[model samples]
Target: MNTFLNPFHLMKRIMLIVTLLLIVSCDGYQSICGLVIDSETKTPIEKAIIKTINPKFKAYSDKNGYFEFHNVTGFIFSDNDLTVVISKVNYINDTLNIKNGDSKLVKLIKTE
Candidate 1:
């Protein structure tokens, strides 16, 4: 009878520990920012598509080629584990891997 009671108590303690971990881990969340520029001219390209493979996240570059990915939460984004595919109407597509929890600068070159 005592052995059976011990398992239930242990399970409850494990669940409580997991719950506390979830709440405290939220403090490590971060956002990302960057700019997209033309590789040749060093000019910024507006409305370029920026995409992440994990979580299937996507954003568009603004007129100044500035992009901000906000509140991107997940465990898969640890330690620079993101891949971005940048594209525009006339430019060639470019793919890059980025570090997590930090800003990045990317340039996409256009080909005639």
Candidate 2:
């Protein structure tokens, strides 16, 4: 039997095409993720506030010092760089110039 004429084969091909389209469309959004750490100790810094300056998206670092902004569309189609600021109570604030779909390791200096 011809593959194109087979009903099951045709259905499978259609499904594959739809799946690929969905995957490609999802690339329009960006995810920003990072780990906040102490500059001197090199340890994870909990309760750190991470935010983007332009689009005003904010997230707090979890106990493991992991923070993420998911499906962020701001600046995704723009040429301007995304600025991220991380700050904690005793740690000095840190800023990073990041792009869409970028992950970074931010180190904050401790305040005396």
Candidate 3:
């Protein structure tokens, strides 16, 4: 007994495989998580507004100055182009790049 495969089916299967590979390998989304701290005192700065400049995402630091971007977390893969802007009253504005899946500590200096 011999088995035969249809050429159209084979082409469709190849196209589907290629599409799936592209979808999985493509960089889709990104996220940022970090701690906002006072540069002088070395203490966590709570309630600071952390906003992404490009994608326009926003979050606020907790009591420990820890903030996590939930939207970014939703994505499984991302590149290295995420910037988070940290700002608070009486403190200097700061910007940080989220990279390497590492948590960053952003220090803000108080203005006189």
- In terms of lDDT, the best-performing candidate is 2
Model 2 clash pairs are none
What lDDT is obtained when candidate 2 is compared to the true structure?
Answer: 0.83
Can you write out model 2's per-residue Cα lDDT over 1-112, one digit (the tens) per residue? 9878899999999999999877666535557899998889899988899988867889999988999997666533465567889989988888898877788998899999
Native-structure RMSD, model 2: 7.3
- TM-score against truth, every candidate: 0.72, 0.69, 0.72
- Which window of 10 residues has the lowest lDDT sum in candidate 3? 70-79
Model 2 error, position 33 (Å) = 0.7
Best-to-worst order by lDDT is 2, 3, 1
Q: Model 1 reaches what TM-score against the true structure?
A: 0.72
Off by over 4 Å in 3: 1-27, 73-78
Worst 10-residue lDDT window, candidate 2: 72-81
Task: State the local distance difference test value for candidate 1.
Answer: 0.79
